[model samples]
Target: MSDAEAARALAEGHLVILPTETVYGLAADAGNAVAVAAIFEAKGRPRFNPLIAHVADAVQAEAIAVFDARARALAEAFWPGPLTIVAPVRDRDRVCDLARAGLDSVAVRVPGHARARAVIAAFGGPVVAPSANRSGRPSPTTFADAVEETGAFAAAALDGGDCAVGVESTVVSVLDGRVSLLRPGSVTREEIEAVVGPLDRDGEGHRSPGRMALHYAPDAPVRIDVVEPRPDEILLGFGPGVGALRWSLSPSGDLREAAANLFRRLREADREQPAGIAVSPIPAQGLGEAINDRLRRAAGFVG
Candidate 1:
């Protein structure tokens, strides 16, 4: 669909599947409670897990969220990129209570995708968008995946091509003069600490999306750090020396490439209908940290 058409759909309180730097999102008007409720119903998402409000830029983000020094610093450094900041709501009335899940704080971000920014700018307001797939499914990185997995529920789908970052944005909660890492993504804790100086690294008491233990999972069971695949399992290989494999996240052990291919590879692996998926080990550094986070969640790790 065209950008104008997507904006019109969002203005009319309809959901649109749009691409972000991280993943395709199921977006709706953040101020419209009815539209936000439709997002929950369409995704089968639990209300307690709040949605992130995406905007065109830091100015639009600050309009809804009360950003303090640290939040502002991070936003200045990472706006138009993969970083989500959780802060107190500046105007509770402006952001529908349903979007924040009745919490005083809201998770907000300025996506780096040009098409997403254009859609938000054209729509003329903040949009409450979560990953454009059913609850607990792997986030869609390609337009075709978004259509195959989530297009049924959206009013329109905007094809912005494959996501660059692949993983979701790094989510940090800056409340009460304290900064805490809620969910690890493309932005690493080390990167955030460099700008904000020492982070709390806490993940509790916040309603940030993608924090659910079993999220981003595929239909088949997943096995992580596996050296050899079971007879009935399909292996998702990372580096060489892994015999036959259903798919390879990266052939040269490049984490950035691996991160980009993670979900799409899992989706392809699951399509084989294997009893389980054995995944080669990924280093927990750089984008690999984010990739492993999703893999661990996909493997059903709680907490």
Candidate 2:
């Protein structure tokens, strides 16, 4: 659909799947309660977790959030890119409580894709979007993935191509002037600290949409064979056990390359459904954290 066509549909309060620097997001008019509800319904998402509203820039984000100097500073440094900042509600009474799950805060970001920015400019209001997939499923990097999973929703989607980041944004919550790392993504904690100073990790307050104990899981049963998984199990290389198990991330233990290849590996492994999958623990560093993060979530890693 044309940008105008998409905007019109969104104007009438409909859901849309749009690409961002991080992942493809199913978007809806954040200002319209009806439109936003459709996103949760379409994805079978619960109302307890709030949605991240996407805007073009500070001007738009300010309309929806009460940004402090820290929030604004971080936005100037990392926004129009892949950083999601949590802050106190802007015009508290004005923002729909449904979007925040009745929390006193909201997660907002300015997407870095040209097409997404254009859509925000065209749609002319904040668009609340979450990973465009059914609840508990792997997030979609391609529009076809979203279309295939969400099935048929009346809203429009911008096929702006694959998300380069291949994951979600780093989420920082600024509460009481203290920064907390709610979730980690492409932007590392070190990078965020460089911008916002040392982070004070507040415990995840509640069941945020993306903060599931078990998230980003494929529709297949998964088992991480850290040691020798099981005899009948589909084996992957750890140090020296590389057999034909349909797929393996890398018997090589290079986390940077591993991070880049994660989703692709998971999708390939999912295709086989060969008993269960095995994983080698790469040293936790740079991209390793992210790689482990996805795996932990996929493996339902708690604490």
Candidate 3:
């Protein structure tokens, strides 16, 4: 769909499925309570889990959210990329309470995708767009998958091709002069720490999204850190030495590539109707941390 059409649909208080660098999102005007409500109802998402508002740039993001020094530094470094900053709301009345889950903070980001920026710029306001899928389902990395999940409910679907990151944005909360990592995503913890010294690593008292266990799952069960695949299981391999009839996340052992392919690979494995999916071990460093975070959630890990 065109940007004008998508913006128009959003202005009218309707859901719009649009692409981002990370994943396709179910978008609506963040200031419109009814529009935000449509997003929750369409995705079957629980009201407690808040949504991330996508803005055109850092200036626009600061208008709704109160960004401290750390928040400003992070936004200056990672705006227009796969990084979300949950900060205290500057004006509660400007942002619909539903979008913030009735909290004083709002999860906001400036997406890196050109199409996403175009739509936001055209729409001329903040738009809250969570991953465009039913709650707990694997996030849609492609337009076709988005159509299957939200096509019926969304007023328009803006196809901007496959998502490059193929995962959610790294979520960090900057509240009370502290930076805490909430959910890992395409951006690494190391990258964030480089900009803002050490991270608090605590998510308590924050309403950041993607904190739930059993999220990003498919129809079949998933087993992670598997070195050997059982006969009945579908093998999702990484690096090398993978046998035939397996989907390799990154044969070159590149964590960035592996992170980009993680969700799509899992979705492909689930499509095979396997008894379970056996995922090869992915080292926990850099982007691998985000990859493992998604894997653990897909495997139904809690805590």
Candidate 4:
């Protein structure tokens, strides 16, 4: 579908599947309570988990949320990228309480996908979007999977090819004069710290999204840090020397490449109906942190 069509669907309180750098999102007009509620009902997502309100630029973002100096600096450095900032709500009417999960704060971001920005720009307001998949399922990173996952619920679906990042945006909260890392993604903690000092790893009471303990799961069971896969399992390998059953994320051990392929590979492996999905060990640095974070959640190892 065209951007104009998607925007029209959103304006009429309908759901639209949109692609972003991170993953395909099921989008709705943030200001419309009925539209935002459709997202939760379609995804079967928990009402307590807030949705990220996407805008065309930082100017639109600031209009919805109160951006502090830290928030502004981070926005200046990472707007139009995969970074979400959770801040106190400046315009509750623009981003309704339902979209914010009834919290006083709202999670907002400027997506780096041209088509997504075009749709939001055409809509002329904040769009509350979450990964286009059923709750607890792996997020769709391709147009085909997005349509297969939740197309029935969307009024229109925009095909923007495959997502580049294949992960959700890195979410951080700039509240109470402190920066807290709510969720990791393609953006690393080291990079964020460089921009705004250290980050509070323990974000206790923050209303950030994507914090479910058993998220990004697939139908098949997942086993992380596996050296050898069981006979009936599919091995998702990393780096070189991954003999037999070689579904290598990156043969050269490149974290960025691995991050881009994470969700797509998980979906592919799940389609095989294997006994379990085995993943090789990935380093806990850079984009690997986000990759491993998703892997751990898929394996139901995260608490």
Q: Which candidate gets the maximum lDDT versus the true structure?
A: 4
Q: Model 2 over residues 168-285: C-alpha lDDT tens digits?
A: 7778887787887777777788888888798886645462447777877875655663755666555444333465433555556655445545665666666677566666665566
What TM-score, over all chains together, does every model reach? Answer: 0.97, 0.89, 0.97, 0.97
To one decimal, what is the Cα RMSD in angstroms of model 1 from the true structure?
1.3
Off by more than 4 A, model 3? none
Q: Model 2 segments beyond 4 Å from truth?
A: 92-95, 225-257
RMSD of each: 1.3, 2.7, 1.3, 1.2
CA shift of 129, model 3, Å: 0.7
Q: Indicate whether candidate 3 or candidate 4 has the larger TM-score.
A: 4
User: In order, how many clashes per candidate?
Assistant: 0, 2, 0, 0
Taking all chains together, the TM-score of candidate 4 against the true structure is 0.97
Tens digits of lDDT, candidate 3, 1-303: 689999999999899999999999999999999888888889888898888989999988999999989999999898889999999898775578998888989989999999999999999989999999988898999999899988899889989998999889999999887898988887788889999999996565347888788889988898999998889998888886664535899888888888878878888888889999889999998888888888898899962
Ten residues in sequence with the least summed lDDT for candidate 2:
237-246
**Candidates 2 and 3 compared by TM-score, better number:** 3
